[model samples]
Target: MNFIKTPTLLKNKSLSLLITARVSSNFAYQMLTVAIGWQMYSLTHSAFYLGLIGLVQFLPMLVLSLFVGHISDRYDRRKIVSISQLVQGICIALLAFGNYNGWITKESFLIMVFFIALAHSFEGPPMQALLPNIVERKIFPKASALVSSASQFAVIVGPGFAGILYSFGASLIYSITAGLLILASVLIIQIHVNKEERKPDPVNLKSFFAGITFIKSRPIILGAISLDLFAVLFGGATALLPIYASSILKIGSFGLGVLRSAPAVGALLMSALLTRKPLKRNVGKIMFTAVVCFGLSTIIFAISKSVIVSFLALFVLGASDVISVVIRSTLVQLETPDNMRGRVSSVNMIFIGTSNQLGEFESGITASLLGTVPAALLGGVGTILVVLIWRKLFSSLFTVDSFEGSKN
Candidate 1:
C-alpha cells in the first residue's frame, strides 16, 4: 500500500480514479465469486454444477465480445464501463432478492450469472483501453503494477470478508456485493477522459474484425496471448477449490476463503515488489519462466494434503501468475495504437476470459471423469507441455529484452 503512495502515476487524478474504481469493482467480483461458488456447491454438491457456473457465464461473453469491442472503440469508454457496472449491480441486487425470498434455484442462479457475464464482457475491453489514456507512457508498468495490486488486494480481502459474512447468510453477502458494485460504477463515472474528435465510421464486418486481424498480424502479441490462454486453460485449479476445501482438505467455508485468498496474497506481495523494481530486461523470457513456475506450483498444490503445503503451493501459483500478468498486460497495451486499443483489448479479453471460464469447465469435467487429483495433475503437465511447445513456436518472444521494444 505504501508503494501506491510513492508512484507518480497515482498523482494523476484520472489514473487514481481508475484504480479506485477497479479496486471497488474487483472487491464486489471477489465477494460474489465466493458466495456463488459456495452456494452452487452447497446446493448441488456436484463439481460439475460448479463447473457449469463457468460455462453459463462464458457463453454470453463469447457471443458479445466482438460487439462490445467495437462499441468500446467508438463510444465513451468511461460511459460504457459505468453502464456495465450498473447493470452488474442490478443483477446482483436481483440475485439477492431471489435468495432472500427463497425462490432462487440452480437454474435461476446460472441465468443471473449469464447476465453478469454479459455486463463483464462489455466492461473488460473499454476498461483495459481506458488505462493508457489516463497514465503517461513512461510509467505504464508502475501504473499497471499498482492497478494489479489494488485488484489483488481486493481479492485478498473480499473472500475473507465473504467467509465471515457468509456465516450469517448468503443473502447478506449478495447485498453487500451489489452495493460495492454500484459504488464502483459511481467512482468510474467521476473519472474524465479526453474524447477524440473523429468522423464516425459506420459499423461493418471489416471494422468488427479489425482487432482479431491486428492480433493475428503481430506474432509477439499472438504469442503472449495464446501462451496465457493455453497455460491457464491447463494449469488453473480455481474451479476445483470448493472440492478441495470440502473433500480433500476438510477445512469448510472459512478454509475455502483462505484457499481463495492465498493466491491474491501472493499476487499482492509480488505486485508491490514489481512497483518498486519494474521488469526492465528480458521481459519475455521472464514471462515464460513465470508461467512454467505457475504450472509446477499448481502440481504441488494438487497433490498436497497438508493445509500449510496447499497454501504455500497456491501462494507460489499466485506469485508466478502476477509476473505473467504484469508482463503480458504491458505488452498488449503498449503495442497497440490508440484507435485500436479497444478492439485489440477486446480480442485479448476474449482469449483470457475464455481460457478462465473454459478452464473451470475443463477442471470440472476432468474432476468428474478422472477424479480431482489426476485431473489437476494432468492440467499441470499440460501447462508445462504448452510452455515447451510455445517456446519452440514463438521463439521470437523469448528474445525480446525490453517493454519498449514490444511497441508495434
Candidate 2:
C-alpha cells in the first residue's frame, strides 16, 4: 500500500491512473479465473474440461499475438487497452447473465472464455508497452515495481474475494468482476502520456516478424524468454489446484480460494522487498537462483499432504518467481528500443501465453493419466531439469551481473 504512495511515481497523473486502472482490471481478471476454474470444475468434475479452459484462452493469444503487437505499435496504446478491457467486461457480463440463468453449458463456458481471451490478447501487449513511455527511465524500475505489486495485490486477494462471493453464487463472482473491469476501462480511458507519435513500420511479412527477429538475435532475451516458457509449461501446478482442493485436501470452495492465493501472498511480500532494495548485483545469477528456488518449492508443495505445508511451499514458490520475473522483465524492456517495445512485448506475451494456457492443457492431460499428486510431482521435477539445462545452454543469461547487461 505504501509502495503506491512513492512520491516520484504519483507525480505523473497518467502513471497514477494507469496503475489504478490496472489494479482494478487485474483484480477482476484474477477473480474471474477463480470463478471460471471453480465453476467449470463444479459442473463437469473433470480435470480435462478444466484444462480445456486454458486451451480456449490460448487460441486467440496464439493467433493474434503478431497483429496485436503491430496494432499496439501503430495505435494509441492506451486506447487499445481501454477498448480491450471494455470488450472483456462486456463478455464477462454476458457470462454472468448466462450463469445466473443456469444456461451456461460446459461448451458455452468454453466459448465465453475464448472471447475473453480475444480481448485479453489485445490488452497485454499495449499495456506493457505503454508503461515505459508514461514515466522517466530512471523511475521505470520503481514504476514497474509498483505495477507488479498492484498485480500481486490482486493476486493476493482476487481469488479469495471470488471465493467469498461464490458462497453467495458463481454469478455473483462474474457479475462483480464484470463491474470492476468496466470501471477499469472507464478510468484508463482518461489517462494521458508524453509519447510522440512515430511513423510505425509498414504492414508486411517483415513487420509482422520483427519482434521474433529481435528476440532471436539476443541470446540473453532468447534464453530468458525460452526458459520461462518451458519451465512454466512443465511446472504449471496451479491448473490442477481445484482437483487438489476437492480430492486431496478435502476443502470447500473457500479453502480452494485460500490455496489459490497462497503463492500471491509470497509474491506480494517479495515484490515489496525488491521495491525497497532494488537488485544491484548478481542480477542474472539471482534470477536463475530464484527459478531454482521456485522449482524446489514446487517439489515441496507436491510432496506435502498437509494443508499448511502446501500453503507455505506455494508461498515460497510465488516469492521466488517474482525475483525471476522482475529481472527478466527489466532486461527485456531496457534492452529493446521504444519503437520495438510493442512487438517485443507481444513476442514475450506469446511465450507467456503459451506457457500458461498450454501448460494448463498439459497439466490436465497429465493429471488424468498420472493422478493429481503424481502430475504435480512430475512437474516439479521437470522444472528443476529445465533450470539445469537452461543454465548450461544460456550461460550468457546466467552469468550477466546487471539488468542492462549486453544482449550478446
TM-scores for candidates 1 onward, in order: 0.98, 0.97
For every model shown, the clashing-pair count is 0, 0
Q: How big is the positional error of residue 125 in model 2, measured in Å on the Cα after superposition?
A: 0.5
Candidate 2 lDDT over 1-408, as tens digits, reads 775556877688888798789889878988998899999999899989988988999989999998899888888888898899999999999999998898998888998999999888998888888888888876666678777877888888998888788889888888888999889998888888788557799889999899999999999999998888888888889999888888888887887889889989999998888877788788888888888888888888887889999999999999998888887788888888888889999999999998899999889988888888888889888988999999999999889986645556
Per-residue lDDT tens digits for candidate 1, residues 1-408, read: 776656467567887788888889988998898899999999999989988998887787788888888988888888999999999999989999999999889998899888888888889899998888877788889889989988898999988888888888899999988898899899898897765554434789988999999998998999999999999999868889989999999998888889989999999999999988999999989999999999999899999999999999999999999999999989999988888888899889888887788888889888889999888989999999999999999988887899998754
- Local distance difference test, candidate 2: 0.86
What RMSD, rounded to one decimal, does every model reach? 1.2, 1.3
The superposed Cα distance between candidate 1 and the true structure at residue 146, in angstroms, equals: 0.8
Q: After superposition, how far is residue 63 of candidate 2 from its true place, in Å?
A: 0.6
After TM-score superposition, what is the CA distance of residue 245 in candidate 1 from its true location, in Å?
Answer: 0.5
What is the Cα-based lDDT of residue 383 in candidate 1? Answer: 94
C-alpha positional error of residue 338 in candidate 2 after TM-score superposition, expressed in Å:
1.3
